[model samples]
Target: MTEDTLRSVNPATGELLAEWPIDDEASVTATVERARVVASFWRELGFDGRKQALLRWASYLVRNTDELTELIHKENGKPAEDAYLELMLVLEHIDWAAKNAKRALAPKRVSPGPFMANHEAVVEHPPLGVVGVIGPWNYPIYTPTGSVAYALAAGNTVVFKPSEYTTSIGVWYARSFALANPQLPGGILTAVTGFGATGAALVTSGVDKIAFTGSTPTGKRIMAAAAETLTPVLLECGGKDAAIVAHDADVSAAADAIAWAAMANSGQTCVGTERVYVDETVYDRFLAELKSKLDNLKPGSGADASYGPMTMPKQIDLVREHIADALERGGRALVGGLESVGDRFIGPVVLIDTPEDSRAVTEETFGPTLTVRKVKSVDEAVELTNASEFGLASTVFSKSHGMEIGRRLRVGATSINAPLSFGAISALPFGGTGASGIGRIHGEEGLREFTRTHSFARQRFAIPGMALLSFGRKASTVAVIRRVIGLKHGRHS
Candidate 1:
């Protein structure tokens, strides 16, 4: 990246994909102002109007899926199938948000207390005006659209700053929305491209809210910057995610799912499995099955590639550092080792007996690697899995106790007897409890996250002599109320 321009390159072959003039603070401010100008128009669109526009955008993307997927494959270096699947997830979310927005954010009546029986109360979810979304590159379309779709469905305009690595895809995303709805105002959805300065500019650009999906440290920095304006933020950050393979589990099925979960997208997923705790009774069998499944997988830019290269070239060094750290700390690798870390792609590296505190076991590796450990029982597995500072997502496998085990896990989303099922379900809210993230995306919780709770109280009628809200309160009314209150409270004990 030069000082004046940002470049996007394919990690698979170092092929230059696209370039753009960087969006600096001044330009970002202008973009935000444009979005802010249309804020009221978007909010006033109401549920039905906005839903139509959002659905059109979804349909447009569906029609142009081939173009977007090819771009994703070229820009982010994921296999074409994976790129298509990511687009499919984005469409599902957009459809869900459009169809469910009314139900999730509409005004609802609330019962007034006994003392205010003559009054009626109601609660409503109002859009937070313009929302600034800083997206990630791993699942650029699926992840950021999680924020963009929901925020727009809830009536908030969005100024999205996609990752520098996937800037063109981000541009395509915003442009697609505009193309889908040419009748709508321009600022309802827009894109600003650049690196850190561009994103930081958006954070401080006075947007009503910022929905960021990125690294934990970057999330902390964005949160701190947003704090200066007391701007509300929804942070979906890093994860050192773990999975448990139980003694009673189907070893074959668990192995297949965990292999994909750990290595897909070159393991750039925030909720992807990085660590595994296998029941000691089936540790050997599980390890063998897992290794067998991964043996058939390969990383390339080809259609048959198990996955593709790491989207960010710099992240390769970090993966190497983790591998070196684990090997030096007495861990043994069953698959690839330090030598597997290549210029573009790192093959699947599976480590066993890595110390619990080793960087490979504790940190967010963000690469195609796995750390497997054996635990005495499911109880021990749960304990070990929850020990990570990142409580983002996890998978549990047990024939009869999958749900039971999942409930005991500390992560925000848990997949029982499956891998990444939580992510596939549009109705499920996804987020973490600790260093993983701040708030949720996807589902009703996600819809409401971009809105503010507004309460309203209306007086139906005023009692002839009871003017409690007015300055004309009477001693007689107070006496009667005290007697009734005492009687009502005295019955509880």
Candidate 2:
């Protein structure tokens, strides 16, 4: 394939799936400009029209779920079942956005401040014209749809750039969306394929906003490029999400949750559990149960496999490097170790007593490997978890105080008594706080993320005593405003 085209290879068999043309900077810019025209029409459709269109798209997705799942399997080397689950998640978001967008984005009356009682004020959310999405290979359908569904529901057109490792699946989505509405080809939703250059082109392509899901370093690069155009970018980046097991927690349940979180999708998820901190009182029990569960899980690109292969081949090396470093630093493997990381599938590698400073604990392994640490108390566990620079989402496995502990953790979303379950709840917002992400998706917050707030005020009648709003009214205007402010807010002081 030439530089203008990209080749999609199946990670499980190293077989080429297809060759697709890549969009250059000029083409990317043109795509965004075209989207702007369609965006105007889409926005004019109002919430009701957009909702109908999105529901049609969701229906198309549901009708073709089998084909889409197979495409994801071929392109990303994930199991067909997992791909189906991802599709289901995407459909849930689409349905939620369609049903909730009108209520979330509709203009609502708000009481004017105490000083302007005679004025009627309202707030309206207007579409952001066009949005550009840069999706990741792992969970490509679910991750990008988090942005695409919401943006469309809020009346914004989107230009999606799926990861080069999974370009065929991205093309499938674009085609299906077009099929949903034959009148709009590149207008409402479009897909661009390629590597990093194509994504960079999208970032600086004059879109109203860019929603990116990838590594923290790549997110920084996207932000920097978007800066050149003063474009707003919402980034869902890397994470070293931790699962904390309190002393009084259910050891078996926590172990099961941790095992699934760390090993699902071969541990390629951004919010997947990478670290586990258990109370020293029950750490041994938890570790034993976790190893027992993880040992039974298998990784392969088959129907019988518990999980699948690494979508990106290069991630295998990083997983190996982290395992080696952990072992070198006096860590013991409870399950699979360096030898488990193969060319395509990374078997479960469970490390125990790993040093805090080790690469396995510090860096995002992004593999089916997890490092378990023992802490004296839940307080210590929280401290250790918060010490990491990446705070995307966390899980607390305490029965009595799971919610309390979750609230104390500094992250975008927290799961109580479960592992990353917050992602499945369509009403909850999903995004990271620090390096995890910049903006949220999946709920009302997600719908608002693609739109801008416009405040409206119309004076029904004049307030005789409210003179501060008028220019050059009177010297008493300042006195009246100060007295009112003191009456309303000064009591607390």
Candidate 3:
């Protein structure tokens, strides 16, 4: 491929799927500037019009499911079923955003304080002119769509930059909107392709808001760069999510869920289970069940494979490094070990009794690996789980105290009795804190992420005696206001 073009290759077999000319700063800037003009047309469409356009795009995606799924598989190195599931999530967010954006961003009336009773106060959420979205290679369709769909529904035009690894998938996702809604203008949704440079250009392209999903280090860099222009950003970054199995947990169910969660999509999921903290009372039972679930699974590029090859080839080294570090630090592998980490496909690797300070335990593996630690009690499990720097999302398994345990975790979203359940629900907002990342995507929080809040206060009628806001206010008004404040607020004193 030429230096100015991107080569979309399959990680499993080194097959070249497609090639496209990449975007640089000049092209990305032009796209964003054009989107700024189109933003006016899209915003003027209002909620109802925007909803129709969004729903139509959803319909197109649904109708072309096979095509989209195949592209996702080819470009993302995910199995067909997993790619379909990812596309399913994209549709869910699109449908939800199309239907709920109005209510989420609708104007609302607020009660004026006693002193300003003559004025009517209202709060309105208007779309920021345009949004720039930078997506990740993992979960290519679903992750970025969380922002693209909601931003479009919220009446903002979007300029999306799919990861260089999955440029084809990103381009297809953006092109779908225009194909589905030819009745609308073209610049409402568009994509720019390339490596990090293209994404960097979008951040400084003067878009109203920037929505990004990627690694923590990259997310921080984007935030810092965007800060130069004082641009607002919605970042969905890294996660080393933990799954806690309490003494009262359903051992078999927890094992079954965690196995699938920790290995799905080659464990590249941002919210996947990377760490497991199990109460000692149930540790043996849970380990046995988990081993059975992970034993037969294998990675391949076929329809019947458990998952598929690692999408990013470089990620395999990190996975191996983490496993080697754990093994060298006195940890024993209960399942596959460093030997199972292939050049492109990594089998399931489960480490037990690893040092808490080990990189595998403290950092994000982003592979089909899990670190299991036995804790003295549920409280100890929570403590160890919360010790990690990443706090994106987590899972809790307990028959009786699941909710209680989940509430105590420092993560953004937690699933009880299930792994990664919060992600499937469209209404729940998804995000993280601390090193995990900033802002949110999905739900009302996501729709508002691309908007600006405006409060309007109109004078309905003037109280003749109280000219408080006028230049001709009487001294009696000040005296009356002081008396009212004393009567209302001083009574408790």
| Clash statistics: count for each candidate | 0, 0, 0
Name the regions of candidate 1 deviating beyond 4 angstroms: none
Instruction: Estimate the TM-score of every prediction.
Output: 0.98, 0.97, 0.99
TM-score of 3: 0.99
Model 2 lowest lDDT segment of ten: 463-472
- Candidate 1 lDDT trough over 10 residues, lowest sum: 462-471
Candidate 1 lDDT by residue in tens digits, 1-493: 6787988888789888888889989999999999999999988989999999999998999899899999999999999999999988998999999999999888999999898899999999999999999999999899998899999999999999999999999999999999999998899999999989999999999899999999999999999999999999999989988899988999999999999999999999998999999999999999999999988788998878999999998899999999999999999999999988989988999999899999998899999999999999988888888888899999988899999999998889999888899898999999998898888899999999999999999999888878876688988988988899999887874
**Would you list the rank order by TM-score, best first?**
3, 1, 2
TM-score attained by model 2: 0.97
Judge candidate 1 against the unseen true structure and give its global Cα lDDT, from 0 to 1.
0.92
How close to the true structure is residue 362 of candidate 2, measured as C-alpha lDDT? 87
- Top candidate when judged by lDDT against the true structure: 1
Instruction: Give the better candidate number (2 or 3) by TM-score.
Output: 3
Q: What tens digits encode model 3's per-residue C-alpha lDDT throughout 86-124? A: 988888999999999999899999998888889999999
Tell me the spans in candidate 3 whose CA falls farther than 4 Å from its real position.
none
The list of candidate 2 runs beyond 4 A from truth reads 183-186, 463-467, 475-493
Better of 1 and 2 by TM-score: 1
